[model samples]
Target: MEHLILTRDLLNTSLHQSRQIDFEIHKTAANVTRINHAFPSLEAAIRNMACKCATFGIRNHVDRALPTVSAVFKVSQVVNELGKLVSTHSASDLNLYLSLVKRFRQALTLLTNTCKLAIPWVEDVKLFLLDGTTDLGVGVDHDHPYQSNVCKTLHLLEELQGTEERSLLDQGILGVAFNKLEDEFRRLLIHNSSPLQVPSYLFSSGDEESDASDPLPPPPLPFPIVQNLRAIAVCFACDNQLDQCMSIYIKVRSTIVKASLQGLDLGYLDISLSEFDSVQEIEGYIDEWGRHLEFIVKHLLELEYTLCHQVFGQLDVWTDCFSKIALQSGIQGFIKFGNTVTKGKKEAIKLFKLLDMFAALNNLRQDFNRIFGGTPCSEIQTQTRDLIKKVVNEACEIFQDLSAQVELQRLTDPPPDGSIPKLVSFVTEYTNELLDNDYRPVLNQVIKIYSSWYDNNKFTKRLVSLEVHNIVKSLERNLVTWAKRYEDTGLSYIFMMNTSCYFSKHLTGTNLGDLMGESWIKRHQNHVEYYATLYLRESWGKISALLDNNDGDVKKRIRGFNEAFDQVYRKQSGWVLCDRGLRWETCQLILQVIIPVYKRHIQNYLALVESEVSPNKYVKYSAESLESMVTCMFQPKLDKYENSTKYTNLMGKIKNVVAGRFSPTTAAA
Candidate 1:
């Protein structure tokens, strides 16, 4: 199946190359430049190039060539005047000329959107889209393995969603269709109990004993033809570039029909689900009073109090596992895994969907009852419940174990201690368990670390870039030394170390060693630490690969952060914490920091992109996901300067550690 799918992919690539679609676009755009005699200048000629509906890929080149066109046009005007040519055109003609030029200019731009939708911090997800079964008919007449209705089902599935199939590489013209496919795919792939992780692809091992006693199942239906889906060009300004990638997608998917007609027993492969995490301010909790008001008075409305109670009990038991784990919750992206969670009453909707699935399983159970009507969910279902319980218990144990390890490290490591480092763990235990039915983990612990200053020291020990690497090692050593000197420095020193280390090691680009040096989980902080980490990734293309669009994620996370920020850091943005007035003194220093940073980078991100090239938009917007970095760090201490004077010395140390006094050349000069 993988080989067959590769063939289809190769064929599609061949088609694109042979078709020369982009090349043809380029030709057509240039052709439009010479369309009318009214284009007296080269810029005028180029600008008028997009009068006809144009693909962005081709026209964007013209847009880039505009300055040359303008120069050419200016020369052309001089030449025309030399030949005694005068302005002889109407306003309508000028409009026509400008419109054409505008088209050409529009072509030159590439729309790159930084998806900033705050993909919430999910534990893990595994969307398994492929499944299969087989039957044996080993008579003399038996030709090949009998694949039941599986192939037929796959065909029906692909055919039923043709409109959606056609729109894979494209994200426009069928937002509904695309979303529908995504939702359905998620339903098929992810389960209510766990994330949507799947088994590793089966690989043949030479000299391995075959399972002849129980013959292996027939292979899955052919791999679904899919594009890597790099980029799409669209006009974000007027939304002219419709999400029409479906057309090209449909053309490419024609291979599916051919494969089906030929009865090829191909298989399928799903992209591993991507993982990302973001920090957001927690929203307000109504506390006991609000809970009683809603749940008690509304008790009759929610008659499933018994079930609710059970669920809460279950949740309590389940949540207890994370207590020692030092686990923290953050915003989760609902529709991030090529799966869209329909917004509104989201948790309720999720439970209802689970209920629907449970109902289906119940129907299956009923069929089982008909087959062995004497059976009960108790005795026979023991295995099922055991599996669930085993998995839950095992997971809790692992969480506890992992958390304990980190806690131990935190106790042992402090600033001024030996070479201890920062670490973080992103354990997708559910994904691993569900996907690794063969019990082989797919997502292992991926670790990276780097060096830095201003971490693990009593103060913010800034160092120059030149000595930053060595100083980073020094800082690590200091942390271990400090750890040796003290008991568990939980809330005070450890918190300060974690907080200081977060700013020093993670803020700019990453340095891996610092991230993974000592206590892997307890000390880890450098892995995409921003609340909007994903949003800052790609600075290109209008159509994100649905997996990592920062633009889509940032806004969502920003809103989340804002809600949390108002209550936490800036509730009294305009006022003092102890007093009842504006904290002007502290505000000034914060502005000193905020202004410089914002001026340096804020508008770096773009709002709109009109491109005729690859689909991914050229992201103009920068520093988006840093919204948390802004509110969390900036406003809380904005006017706390008087109270924060002690940290000023630390800040100076950090500045020196991060950016030194001078280089050799400067000192010598």
Candidate 2:
């Protein structure tokens, strides 16, 4: 019975030991099970942390979320460690490694979506992804292939999500970005503000060792903001969103115009000649102004071709904007310049400068037309016309003043030679010089004004005629004084005749003849004839005194007559007789009046001195001798009166009558 009790105790002890061992094994198994189950919950915790990280990264700070992101990566590493444990323990049924991997992918997806939401712009996203804060290998070890996969997958997902989100975001906000960019440009250009600078990395030239000989870098390519805006505009265009693109284009074009015009110094337009001492200085200023305008216009045209057309693919809108600016700034500026030049005291030199300014403006207009391809702007045309009219009217006033001076001189102090000839020469020279210059365009229009006056009331024609008539009247008065100043009637008559002839001939030769009517010419001719007749009568009256038939001492009378006729012929031959007809008629009248009386006296003398020994000496008073003397009495030689039909007829009648009274064949009847 004792032996039985010992065996039972031993069995109980052994049974107790066995039961403890079994309990230890079951506790180990349960703890293993709990450890195995904790991985999924840990994955859930990691995933929750990753989601929180993504939310914080996107909503709060992306570039500054590096610590949080590092924590998430640490959690992912923990997940990776857990995954390895599952693989090492042969726990395939739980699929812990796959679950961790799948959870990590979810974390990566969250990270990628956070990046996409945080940085929408493609360029910004690229920059953010490259930034050190977003490094995916922050705490991830390469020993775990899953972590490396997560890192690479995170990058791939970022790329895919970034590309997609960028497209939608760009499409949605393209117009807004472009408009903001244009507004900034407008503010800079219109307000003349400094431009914003771009980062070197974004706009690197890659040519840091620039050639020293190269020209200054072109104005920094449009600011990066503008660059980004332009890129978006192009994207919009590609998407058939042309209206938004055009809107941006127009805004940019207007800003360019404003910028170009702002570069011009419009103060030069108000320059005054009084500020300059000489025309050359004014010309220099004008040239400088022109150069400035050219520079501005050149820049504007470059923008139109290079930027506007390339970006917007249209030219008309830009050209139209350019036209308005050109008219407003360039043409109006020149117009004001012209006004300034013409404002001061009227001087011929200043007028010429104004004319030069007008020419420059015309040339500029032509250039604009060639570049812009249209008719001259209306403002330019209108301003040009106004300038022309002002210049011409100023010239007319100057001319009128000069003409008045000439009239005053004539009225106040009439010279012996008369001022009419002086006036004629002056007017001719003035008109020729004016017409010879490059003022034809204005002069042509001026002529139309004069023509209108002529057509309306004949005012211009009458004014010209009146001026010429006044001149002639002045000449006639001076001539009358000259004629009366000389006491000798023959001398006075010769003077008057020559003077009148010259005056008439001069009138016919010059333009004045047209102004003076035909009646004036006839009146002058009559005056000349009357003077010539008076000269003939006065000159021959002395010779007629010695031809009396009743005087005693016929021989002495005939000898005295011969001596007097010789003295009178010598004295009168030197006088001027401009008209051939007047001279011939004077000679003929002298012969008619003197020859008949001389012939009668000679016949009576011969009969009275029939027995005288010196009859040949007294026979010098015959008709043939008188005819030869009278023919030689004028400036140009004249034909003998006896060669004329009237003289021959009178001689024939006299000869027939005398033959009946005395013997025709006797030396002394």
Candidate 3:
């Protein structure tokens, strides 16, 4: 079914070509009638010249040239007959019309060669036509007068300018022939075009497979089509219709080029920026935009440019032809999309996509200049360069704006379990992507040009590194502000510990880690230690200080210690340290400081502990037991309300058992 449809379409196109050719043939037939009328006058002039040659005793040479002159006139008559056949040809019988055109072209070629040969003698006739008499003296040997017949026929047409028999050979006969060639050129180009396969480099890592060193030339057109096209191009040149031929070639090839690009499913290139609701909405399109841009420039456009040289190099206008097609079909769409994205709202996520575009274009910088580099394609060159600059500037602004984005995240409440804040997590992951190998170089270029830290300053780290560091620093500063909202000084330190520890631990082995270095990790780790010390002092330090009271109220101090220990344990148990290693180390730090000191103070009250019938009230737990209790702090809280209620009820029961074991009511019972 598809084949039948395609055949119909081809038939329609051929019929159209035939009708156009038939119309031109009709115009040329009128010119042929004028040429036929001039033939009689031209033969009369040749006979008069033959008489003159006899008078000069050159009749033998003139007699020999007469047969050649007759052959030239016979070829002109054949051209006139073919013109009539072509004019009456049916559009449905296009093959016959084209065959007739081939014969007509052959006849024209023969006539043109004969004209060139007789041009010298025709100069005398041309002078005679100008003043209505021969300029050459009759006594002088009319050099090759028989050779001048073909030339005299053309000169006769010129001399009969005011007469009704004036020939329109240049504009009428050759115009029809060149028009046929033009249609054939368009037909061959359209039929031979094929959809390009997707190149690997578009999806793979940056130019790894399809390197610039391995240039891919345009695939060859069919051999028969190429020969026919070359023949047609030569004919156009011979007929002085090069401009007409080039115009048609550019128009047809440009349409095919644009259609090929559109076939890649890049319709978003034509979408307006206002159609997108958010800046991030264009991210997927931008990603595709980068891949397609690289593919088009490196493979598709490059092949078209090469193809132009292959097809049109004879006319020395291939560069101009290729430029018009490239700009019209491919490069302009890419440039428009790039410019639209640059004008989008500033966003950190958009920055990476913009960097992808920048990198794609930057990679093709040399290719662009090589392919579209001259006066004919100056608009393309200028537009692409401007788009690159806009992308860079927009990306830089968005990247630098990251610090402001970080500063604006001033949520008062941190995570409830003393875990890392969402803002901190977002910033870490965001910066990690920014420091990726693909994006880092473009970002570095952005920073080197736009970063204030890059000016006149000698720094060991790159400007991208410094900018990322500033973003990280901004996150750290925001964390401090968030940590202040936690009223429990101990939980406040835990929040800081959770954040800094997360930054140090999770970012290790990542691009951001490599940029921040070991020192950066260690510094954050030291912050965890510092926060741990402060936590131990603010929380367990006060609880351990209960044992340092030296008054004689031993039971009171023991009771006080038990209550304080229970209160702090129950409260801190619900808190969490997201990093397991940090959680363990923090728990150990509290135990090491408090357990031994409490144990030594308990030794002073051993007799009291032994005197009580039930000593578990004041001496709630042993030294080892206290260490176990403190070790369990900073674990995840209960998730279900039922479980939490059960745990609370169970703890109440345990406390009642310890309290009632030595009560007076229990002893009386």
TM-score of each model, paired residue for residue: 0.16, 0.37, 0.69
- The lDDT leader among the candidates is 3
Question: Residue 133's C-alpha lDDT in candidate 1?
Answer: 21
What lDDT would each prediction earn against the true structure?
0.26, 0.47, 0.66
Candidate 2, residues 1-669: lDDT per residue as tens digits? 433453465456545644554454455345435533553453344354345446433223333333433444344344334423322332122234334434434444454455554324322323443444553424334444423333443443344344223322322222222233333333333232222222232122232433455433244235643444344444444435445445534444554455445534466677666533334445445545444444444444444434543333342343444454455335466556666555555533343344445455555655555445535345556666677566556544543344343333333322232112223323333333333335435434443464464457343434534543554555456456556655566777776665565545544534455555677767778887887678667877666777674566877778878887888777766554544565677678878777877888888878887787886776765689779878765552332322121121222223222221111221011
Runs with alpha carbons beyond 4 Å of true place in candidate 2: 1-461, 499-522, 618-626, 632-669
Cα lDDT for residue 314, candidate 3: 80
Give the Å error, residue 602, model 1: 44
Off by over 4 Å in 1: 1-200, 204-380, 397-405, 410-499, 503-669
| Model 1 C-alpha lDDT per residue in residues 328-410, reported as the tens digit of each score | 11001111211211111121112222222222233344433332222322333443333323222332233223323323333
lDDT of 3 by residue, 155-190 (tens): 643333312122224335445444545666766776
lDDT of 3 at 65: 50
Segments of candidate 3 deviating more than 4 angstroms = 1-176, 199-220, 251-255, 271-278, 328-330, 404-417, 428-436, 448-461, 472-485, 503-523, 547-559, 591-632, 636-669
